[model samples]
Each structure stands twice: as C-alpha cells, then as structure tokens.
Target: MASIPPAMAPSTANWHWKNKNVTTWAKTWFERELPTISVQDDGNEVSVSEVVDVDGDVELGQRKSKYVPPMY
Candidate 1:
C-alpha cells in the first residue's frame, strides 16, 4: 500500500493511551484527511445560523485524510 506510510508510529505518549490498538490507529489515521460532507436534516429545514457551532473547536478544525480508498 503505497498510500500507507511504511511504518507505524505513535504520537503523544504511552501514558495517554490505555489501548495500544486505538493509539496506533490514531497515528495512521492522523496522516490522512477526514472527509467532509454536508447533509440537511431529514426531518427539518434549518438555517445555517441555527446549527452552526461557532464557539466549538469541532467547527473550526478539519479531518486529516485527503483521499478515500477505492475499496471503500
């Protein structure tokens, strides 16, 4: 898998992770951009201002993975 880095490296520290699998996955996942999709609420039509979280970091930051694997 050329897209995948040839190594598994952990960020942060050992003390931060109780589960090694999750920590390892996080490292790999962090190297890619997460997808961003926008969908309307199926039940209602809400204004952008009504749903936006201006104060939260979740609204401010982006996901890592730039591509989606073809198998997906």
Candidate 2:
C-alpha cells in the first residue's frame, strides 16, 4: 500500500480516484493503536498483564478509579 497524502484521509468521503475502493483500503490501514488496548492481571503478584482489545477511542483525560495493591 502506498502512503497517504496530506490532503486525503481514510474516511467515508474519498477525494482521489485511487481511494474509491474500500476493499483494498482496509489492508492499507493495518495498525494497532494504543487507545483500544488495556492491561489485565490474572490474579498474580509478579506476573505481567496482557493488553486486550477494547475498541473505539480511549479517554485521554481524567481517571475514574484508584489503584489498590493486593499486598501492602
């Protein structure tokens, strides 16, 4: 896939004739953003958490909850 120009974006409305086809465009935008990712703990103390797919944009502002350690 070719690189996107400054004017064109991968949205519903396509400007150039090359971006009219949505089938091939899907593969062109194969990326994994950090917003739709998360970390989960499997009831372990010294284990690393796994990042899961949450979908959609992630909130960048404010925290909703507090952190609590299993052992303190």
- lDDT by residue (tens digit), candidate 1, 1-72: 315323324345433322212333443343432323234687765332222222311111111322222231
Compute each candidate's TM-score over C-alphas.
Answer: 0.18, 0.18
Per-residue lDDT of model 2, residues 1-72, tens digit only:
345423333444333233222323333333423333455678634422433433432211111222222232
Candidate 1's displacement at residue 17, Å, is: 15
Q: Output the worst ten-in-a-row residue range by lDDT, candidate 1.
A: 54-63
The reply for model 1, stretches above 4 Å from the true place, is: 1-21, 34-72
Give the range of the ten consecutive residues with the poorest summed lDDT in model 2. 58-67
lDDT of 2 at 57: 29
